[model samples]
Target: MGELKLSTKIGYGMGDLAGNLLFQMTVIYLLFFYTDVLGISAMAAGIIFLIARLWDAVNDPVMGLLMDRTRSKHGKARVYLLYGSLPLGLATIAMFYAPDLPMGGKVAYAAGTYILWGMLFTLVNIPYSSLTASLTDIPQERTDLSSIRMIFMLIGVIIVSVATEPLVSSFATPSRGYFSVTAIFSLLALFFFLLCFRLTGKAASESRKKDESYKLGEIWPLLLKNRQLLIVTAASLIGNMAVFIRETSAIYYVTYNMGDSGMLPFFLGIVVLSMLAANLMIPLATKKWDKKGTYLIGSAIGVAGSVIFHFIPYDQTALIFLFGALSSFGIAAISTVGWAMIPDTIEYGELVTGKRAEGISYAVYSFSQKLATAVAGITVASVLQWSGYAANIPVQSDQTLRGILSTLTVIPVIFIVLSMGIIRLYAIDRTTYEGILLKLKEKMS
Candidate 1:
């Protein structure tokens, strides 16, 4: 593979920053908005989130198949990003701003628009994910891209963390956090999606694929038969669920368990520090342990953090937060390397199947993420409802506090432990990934 120009790296980095700002914000605040500000019950909110995610499950592979078949001089994947950004942005805003309607009607409105935004997200995200493979087949360049992309993604997460709650308070009634925050982010996302479109240039596919047309039946077999992809996807699904819970529960835990709303910012700041620290370590960690080891070390730390959190006294809020930082340190490394692994797995799929299903591969990957997030949303909301959770209520029952703590401490520990086991099966160590890239380069050249 030829060396990547600085422009290519910088361009891709900038493009991801644009996409992630909306993506991260949606993941962080979407459910919160549905439950707290929308006057929807937590259980109802969970059901809504699950239903929308089911829509993603159906739509993701369809988008993947469509993207795979797409043909343009600019390349198969980049064209969609150019054209699809606007619709995605529009629907994203609309999802949060449906007309004033009855409760059932409002739920239906959110479900319809939310599903539409998700489809639009896949239309762009699957193609965009596959674009990394098109950039340069060099293993090192792939790592560089992943590192920069994840760093920018964290920057976006920090933006959502810092901005969404405050932004909501600024826009509508403080009670309507969901509507206001989503509206604000929708505009912000629109701007960035367009920026992503402008920043990324198209790359010509090296070999014209004979089957650049979607075969509806062939897609599933292609994904299912790839044993390595299956294992990685399983791990990704579980790990991502853990991540969503960690992010989603912080508000409930802080407000109800600790009795302080101000601590949310401090807790998130620890996350920022942890992510920054991980970003700082990327270059050095990759050099020392390579991608696989970095990820293993990360997973180990995550589990350790979960276990430690269980033992921490709830009364000692400050100390518990410090442990939280330790765990986020682990999450940071996973964020950096986990994405890099996805492309590698896709390459492995190509090796085994003699088919380039980058769109399907990335779609399935993102689908797992969506499913995990969806499950997390439903579980958290259901638990909140069952535990007698009420927003800004004068006082939560002891049962509610216990429920929040159990969800925060116990359920996540189970999933993270399972994540570690799945991660252990990921066969594409750094050596194999680099070898795959080298072989691809030689064949292309």
Candidate 2:
């Protein structure tokens, strides 16, 4: 494979842009959608989140195995991006569209539609992520690709964060507003998918082996042997709990704790801006401290900011925003390097087993991430339910407000710290990765 052109890089980045169009909604608003809009109880919403995403997590590896065996003219990974877009897009709309049904029926609909969306998402997401490993073997190129990809993802996050509340308010009712906004986003998602499909040509297919033969049963052994992958997976699982839970709780924080649901967009926008700035700074941070060191620094900052925010009064809106931005920026610093780390594990796998199972490698990573979200979703919902959160209430009780605060701050701080410790087990560094690549090239020659 030759060097990737600027156009190809943008094309690759667009795929994530498409996925995040729907994903950011789920991360930040899905539970709220189920509870407030669809009239599900908080506990019920938590159960729904748990069941849907656990199934989604379990199903990821199955899709990964199928992708490993896939032989298609359109290309293994890219073909899914082309074909899976419409179904995924439709499911996104359906997840947000609440039907006028009885409580049980609505609960069933939420679970079914959410699960379908997750399935379609895995079909597109695993392939899109695996494509990075195939796009280039150069570590620096992978870094560039990861950075570019995250920048686009942050753009999607920003668009959704800044627009969702205003769009909802623009409609006569919140339900109608959510449906309309998601419908538009779904179309944009499809277009981005098509563009990504067209862009994944020879460059993204570089890692595709002509004579690759691997059984699905071997995936477990591959995962067990790849120590770097395990370390990355564990670290991500812990870290994502903090990220997903904090995101899930932010709207609730702004609404109940800060006394204004109208301010949701403003708070989300600040976080998005912080994330964007952090993404831009990742390359410099990595250069100075390396990925592990940079991630630790970020985690420490996040933990500190989250802890401080918990103690401060919510009436201090300016201080709240400042702490929120600082915490988010730290989280973004850890996330910017996530995709880059997975590709390096591809080389690690090849060296260990003489097979480059990028699909399965990324699947494990994706699976862990989705599983973390499931846990966080369930945890957040359970907390709100236990904490006495009542939907459509003008003001929550002191217990509910306190629970929301813990959800936003203490829970995430603990998880972020745990992840920082877990990352210490990861063995791969620039020196180690370069050595592995050099050895692999020698073997190929």
Best by lDDT: 2
For candidate 1, write residues 1-445 as lDDT tens digits. Answer: 3466676666677656667766765666677667665666778778777887877878898888888888787678878877887787777667666466789987887778778877888887788777677776666677888877777677767777777666666655754565566566666666665555555563334423446554888888889867777887887788777777878787788777887766776777677768777876776787788776777788778778777887787679778888888877886665567677777777787767767788888899889877887888887887888888888685799888877876666787777778778778878767787787677657667
Clashing pairs in 1: 33-178
Report the alpha-carbon TM-score of model 1 versus the true structure.
0.91
Question: In candidate 2, what are the lDDT values of residues 1-445, reduced to their tens digit?
Answer: 5478999999999999999998998888888888899999888877877787768656887888888878898778889998999999999999999899999999999989988988898988999998888888777777778888989998899888889888888999989999999999999999998998888775765654744478867888978988888888888888989998998888899988999888888888898888888878887888788788878888888888888888889899899999999999888766767777888887897899888887888888887777777877898898988998899897999999999999889899889988989898877789999899899889898
Which stretches in model 1 have alpha-carbon errors above 4 Å? 175-181, 202-214, 314-317, 434-445
| Per-model TM-score on C-alpha atoms | 0.91, 0.97
Error at 73, model 1, angstroms: 3.6
